[model samples]
Target: MSGKNVPFQDLFVTMTKVAKDAVPIGGLVLIPPKNEHQLLFVLGGTAKVQVDHKHSQPILAADTHFIIKPGQSLQITNQGSHLLDISIIACEVVQLSRADHKLSAASVKTFAYFQYETVSHTPRSLRAMVQKLQEPSTFIDMQKLLENQFLFQKLIYLLMDSHASQTDADPRHAVESTIEYLKLHYDEAITIEDLAGIAQLSRRWYTTLFKEITGENPSDYLIRLRIDKAKELLTMSKESLYAIARKVGFEDEHYFSRRFKQKVGVSPRFYLHNRRILGTTVTHPELMYLLGTIPIAAFSPDQEFPSYLLEAFKQVPKLNNSHHFDPEYFKPFKPDVILAAEWKDYENYDALSRIAPTFLLPSHNDWRDELTDVGEILDKKKQAHRFIRWYDDKRDEVREQLKLLTNNETVAYARMTQEGLIVFGNQSSRGKILYTELGLIPPEKSLLHIDGKILSVEQLAGLGADHIILQIGEQADSSREALLQQPGWRKLMTSPTSRIYTVGHREWYNFSFSPLSTGFAMQHMLQMFERGVVR
Candidate 1:
């Protein structure tokens, strides 16, 4: 009787029942083995179906249909966020002889069951049939029994057709089908060769086509998908890291951590701590450095850094030529939080916020206020306050020293660029350090704007300052040398009361209002004024 398929005409439906049940979140439904075969169709939500307490598959609404054989127990757990609605159809079948128009008692076997494969897309009529079967019938007449028999046979035929269509599908269609399967079963241990076989393609060709289509190899794509799910569970659930690792298809937690870091730029523990910070602007990195934590990555539009920070940030990866709010570029290095300055042109805030907790500091906020906000986000308010205090003390000390060395002498900061001479105003970071913090006065004709303003050499000379701190740009070295050959520059160089000091452009221009760069800029200024040279 085992594994025997009775002819359609010989099969008779003795009894049939339709049961509709709703399982709440975290609810469980167990159906013990009975003498009838059962068809389970998910009406809504998701359920983890376990057959015979061994085989398990996640069934989603309208996507899959399951059959439970007689003597096989079924277990369903609500795995989705909402209620799980499912319809179960149980029916008893026995062989009947049409010759005598009688049921064959000897052919009634308890272990006999239909060998139907699970179908992903059940027939549209199947649901309607199940609903009709649910209609009230106070008396079981011969006509009602014959109608049930006809419907049951139609369902068996639909299941058979679905299995045949899938098995006989074109190779290309099979590959597409396999890709859908991969998305649903990424947590399962799947191998490349197994996927290729499902796609009915050679492994090499399958991998090549997969990469060409998806921009990643099959294995890498699968791992990235798994990692994305792992990230969701890590942040949304209280599951342990080990449990998460196993749930996401990784057998070892250490291996999971290594892969996570490779993909996300931080270990799982660091991610859980919310320490994998990504700085979308130069200022955020400087502030994070002052907070005693290095960002996982920092945006460097020009691939440049201050001389003082070059060594400390030598190992940090630089994000070059990236849009201000490009979330796709930042997705691979899955940071715990993203720090960005509010930009007038920023339009993709939602995209970045989807990747991590994004903190957009006001663009008009002072560096101190920005640091306070960042500190709060990273849970390092104490460090932020301490650094602010230390900066204030240092500024006071530097101001007194400057006043003593050059009493009321006007000092100016300028940078030599390929375009022309650019001077900093009181609003700039370097300008704030010298004119605001250290009490040094800027030349009267210098640009007083928030950023560098280009000026002619004559306009710079017109300011008539006693001292000038000039930063030499990378492409302006020849310009600097050529400027030195000018008569006006030589006059200032040899002047008894006037002096000019040169520093690297990278060091000067990268300095922001953040404490780390601000403090470094202050030390550089003091070194120039005391030693008459930039060290």
Candidate 2:
């Protein structure tokens, strides 16, 4: 700012309110615009502000704030609620030059790219400053105002530091690096400890860190990456299942098929067969396009498949960063890459091969791995890596939490079983019981393309849940049978891992068995699992 009278020095700062009777100055013009920049700070309640034709989201609660350009359309609304208490601030500064050009008065532009689709680092500094101002104040002198503004600058510095550190020094960053390694070397036989060692962190710490970030552990996340890579080779390239398996870290094609079925929900044979390779392969550059294998987004195994494509798109180069992916608004595009996660979409994975290569991840696989596989197909290894690291991190976090819980003086387990099915007949918010809250998350929030149906058993498996109340409903009976008979179940049950303790013995499966009271039966079963009283 070469000008003598700097606009920043004369900034107006004040509290805004409407009159007692009328709309108590629900709005205010801080410094009646002589073409000055304005920044509105929300102190309390909700408000809607507009800049030119663009309206900001209704500012809710304290700490909400926004910046507007000179002559920008600005308005505030109480939204039929109590008049909001807000702080008004403004300045008319010569804009800073973005390029290497000197900061001449003619070349300067006000830094007003503060509006955000999300809480990003660029504007967070100013937002944090506003939030700090919203806190109860003591003295209000020019020095105090200057101090507050200085803190804003400091926040900007910290945001820059945090961003720089995340891409480089952050412990979670290793997961992403590992994904790139896996994508190129999916055929390599890698161990969890081996991957953790790549990051120079202890396995326990790596698992927790991985899970915290990526939502999947190292081994599981890596499997998805390998499977996806294998899909690309299996269909697009003329590789046998064994060759693909060997390339993607599986020692045997049979094991690969089992893992593929778990994660992709279809065996390799079914996937390749369902999706045809219509186009002939090109030799010079090896231009191969993978087709159809779409994961089904199910409302239920029985209901009609959702016509709605709860879609997302991305061109991410690595993890902890995304170029273009939105879970909110649905914009129609060819989806250069589309993820077909519905049973119907998967029927002809070959059809999509013509579009771009697509892979179907089955629900039987943990949702995180399924997500990672899609990422691998799109060459978004970093995102997958971040996810794997996050999951690994969280598992240890939960394990440590469980250890603390078990060590507590009076630990209790409220188990679930068929005979104890009556226990949860009428209850809300009781601790440590098997339950589902389908209504809590909308369709978009859910990982499964599912509606009301829930696979809490999978969730429990992931969380290392200690007990199951196996409700004695028709669904329960069917589930119990599957649990007892399934090979997957036998491996977990026979080998006593995951601290999974079933309260009742095999004898309680009788349809005629009845509990005197649902609550008491549940309580008794829970105690049995905890104390091994039933055994």
Candidate 3:
């Protein structure tokens, strides 16, 4: 700004809201679109702010402010139950001249090419000045000061000074840099001590911080990342499984296949078969999809399908009557076997057996067992094995991708209900995929428990996980929302690595128990993990 005065003018504050009601849990509040630049500050309450798909962050700390550039839409959602208070200061850039050229008066246009930044912590001098000006005793003085050009000049200079003093210093900086290194050299043999050396921290301290931030240990993270890369090559390219395995950091292809089977429940070779033929109506549509077969008819309690099952069920007829399965509905789509899960009523099993060779599928923690049984029943045991292999390949791919994104961070899955939060175990559901299948580390506290246990807010908060996957049920209300506003929940939100991811309750609860649900769940979970944080 080469004018006779400073580059900015202190326009009056445009809007102020105090103790504004919070948006309900899983609800969003949109900031009215504006064509003018505005300085928005999060005066109180923590929220998640998303400006389009590329810009999103948690507003947990106070005084978190960001510039709303012209033509930008801001979406602020209350991640907590407490009311969110905010204020907007509308400002203008003064008309200036530099070297015979007229400077744009529009603040956005003026800084169009320059990178705009935020001042999280006000400088000491500026803070003191603002405090003094805001004092009740200085009411008249403040009014007079606002009317003077000197006030605008001082503010402009202070902002510039603050920007100049900003430094790239943050706690996560080391971890982020080390992850970048890992991504670039994922194909190489890397070790925990080596990564710790990259961070320039002692091995124990580095490992601790890595797990605290990423949810897994360094060795597991590295191995998973390599396997993920190998999976991409196996699926998207024409490379042989052996070559692919070696390319992704495995020394022996046989060893790679063993590890892949243990983690993914299938061999790489068996996973490549793309199609399967099913001659009959199957009760487990999700399982059919997992086994690489499209069912003639699918049974669900209702028409509302989980995201994982949505695409597969689009054209398939639903053998459902409202929220229950009717044995009569199976008569229309008569053909082969009906795979009835043990979780459902078996009285109709005999009736279903009459319609077709209905096999009562045993419900189990390990989804592979269900898959194997379904294969055996359908006389596609070979195809089922191939599906498992395919699933394992996909699992490896997802694990690798997550290893890069999550590093050593751990993830915890919990469900919010009327009673309390339910901490899912690592052996089933999203927990199994996120922790066991995906190779993500669980918080030490979570390791002590198994799945299907309800936890108090204190337990959920104290789980010590770096990231949380909060499963929201269909019947969830304000009471469930209030649970998030608890002191424990607030503490979890304040951590540097604290991130809460919301997923539909139905999608996660039973998706892991069956092969059908597991396939879709694995695909959906991988996509979520790769996307990193959810807003």
Best by TM-score: 1
**How close to the true structure is residue 183 of candidate 3, measured as C-alpha lDDT?**
60
lDDT, candidate 1, 1-535, per-residue tens = 3223343445554447778889999899999888888878886778888766554564656546777777777889999998988888887766544654322211221111244435466667567766676655545576876787677666665655565476545555445555665665577777888777655589998887777667889889998988887876765566899999999889999999999999988888777766578877767787888887888888653556666667888988887744434467889997866776678324455567778766677775368888888877766788898888888898899889888777788898888888878788887766776777778877783355656788776677777878887878756778877887888777666666667777765555555556665667777777778876331
Rank ordering of all candidates by TM-score, starting from the highest: 1, 3, 2
Query: Over all chains combined, what TM-score does candidate 2 have?
Result: 0.25
Candidate 3 deviant stretches above 4 angstroms: 1-283, 301-303, 308-311, 319-329, 332-336, 427-430, 445-448, 477-479, 482-491, 506-510, 514-532
The models' CA-based lDDT, in order, is: 0.71, 0.43, 0.60
How does model 2 fare in lDDT?
0.43
In lDDT terms, how accurate is model 1?
0.71
The order of the candidates by lDDT, greatest first, is 1, 3, 2
TM-scores of all candidate predictions against the true structure: 0.49, 0.25, 0.42
lDDT of 1 at 259: 96
**Candidate closest to the true structure, highest lDDT:** 1
